[model samples]
Target: MVRPVTPASAGFRARGALVAVAALVLLAGCSADGEADAGASASPSSSVSAAPSSRPDPDAPLDANQACAAMYVDGGKTLEERIGTALVGASDGLDGTSADQMHAMAMELGRLEPRVPEEFQGPLEKIRVPFLQLQEALDLADGGQVELDIASTVAGLKEYEKLC
Candidate 1:
């Protein structure tokens, strides 16, 4: 017998979708050993060497390629890895620690926004926006919003894939 979807049922479906998406993103970011793939730097035009430190120089100007390299390669922990970690954590449960991690990653992206080339800003913002929204939804215990936030985050990650 076909059953009309109720609000409660819809919430459960959304939560399930969010969990599936989070798992996919996390798996995409890791390898068999569960470590981030070192060679998974985003740029395709040329090979960029890892920087001495994880962070780019705040004082120095960066081109789009250099900025992309700094974001994914220079850092021992790539931004992609961080995003995967945060999303998986949030999907596991809306705990205080997971919310804090999401906020931290969003802030990290915010700090890097100005340092990157002008072309990269929009894509970066796309990813950052959902991170913040998801954190807020978690704090508020909004299940529907949490699902929407996660979908937005996945979409944002797709946008970022084109940038690098």
Candidate 2:
């Protein structure tokens, strides 16, 4: 006879499964074939990523953008040097919310995706509006109501995390 899984147990198992998949995708994206890697840094280009030893630890809990942000410290650069480059190569006509918008944004992400090689596109792709929301929350956080701002950002990020 098959045993039933409690929601708590099932939820934990599901989360573990997601974490494993994210790790695998992260691994597959590495190795840009070197020649391409050397070309960008030598000129004005959008290739962005943290140095390997300096990469944001892929294992940090999803809630900790702070930890990843810290990797940006130390006078170094990230795989996608700018947030726009990190999100999509060209914003061009993109603006605001729409179903197709997210995928459009993600389509441009290929050039920049390997920068944050540890992330699966699933998590990053979900950031379309939530990322905007998080930015608003972070900006608002400076108003001395930091806790509220963080709460808002976390809520948005949780929404993004749901996609993963």
RMSD of 2: 17.2
Estimate, for each residue in 1-164, the C-alpha lDDT of model 2 and write its tens digit.
11111212121122332333234323322332132334434432332444535554544342223223322221244322332232221122223432144344334343333444354333344333333432344346442211111122223234333322
- Cα lDDT tens digits, model 1, 24-75, are 5555444311221223333432334665455534757666656655555556
Count: clashes, candidate 1 = 0
Which residue pairs show collisions in model 2? Answer: 48-78, 48-79, 48-80, 48-81, 49-78, 49-79, 49-80, 50-78, 50-79
TM-score of 1: 0.60
True lDDT of residue 122, candidate 1 = 77
Model 2: lDDT to the true structure: 0.31
> Which residue pairs collide, candidate 1?
none
lDDT value, residue 78 of candidate 2: 32
